[model samples]
Target: MPVKLAQSSFRDRTQEFQSVAERLRKSFSSGPGQNGPSSNTSRAEEQRSVVAHQSEFNRRASKIGFGIHQTSQKLSNGQENFSF
Candidate 1:
């Protein structure tokens, strides 16, 4: 016998897997940086700036990808709702 899967089940699993992958990618990508801290004040400021930049980039990229994914999913559903 052939195996079968529900649509919602596949979508939920794939989304969860993708989310975990993204988190791992982000964590590993942010490696150590050079330019040691000159002083506590300056170090703290630099760290904040770095975090802000990374967050902004991640937000923008996620937004774009999410929009595209939504569109593709709608199209894939055959543009019809069949209920019984």
Candidate 2:
């Protein structure tokens, strides 16, 4: 079955997704104490920070994916005036 969505709504969702994805990319690219090269202690901290950031990114991505899925389902169910 083909699902129909308003052009503006599709664009809005795409932009929102891109914005979040960019933010996540930026955050994940930078680790703790990103001012300069890391010392031994800072290296450990950086590793931990990387792990934490990865976990957070995964959680947020999962949430966003699920939300998108739900919204898509709702839209497919003939809900036209929906906004997220």
The model with the greatest lDDT is: 2
- Could you tell me the TM-score of candidate 2? 0.41
TM-score of each: 0.45, 0.41
Measured on C-alpha atoms, candidate 1 has an lDDT of 0.79
Instruction: Give the worst 10-residue stretch by lDDT in candidate 1.
Output: 31-40
Put down candidate 2 lDDT per residue, 11-83, tens digits, no spaces: 3488888999999998678866663654547778889999999999999999999999999998788655656
Candidate 1 shows a clash count of 0
* Runs of candidate 1 exceeding 4 Å displacement: 1-38, 79-84
lDDT of 1 by residue, 1-84 (tens): 998965663234888889999988875676445333455567688999999999999999999999999999998786567554
Check candidate 1 and list the clashing pairs: none
Q: Candidates' lDDT values, in order?
A: 0.79, 0.82
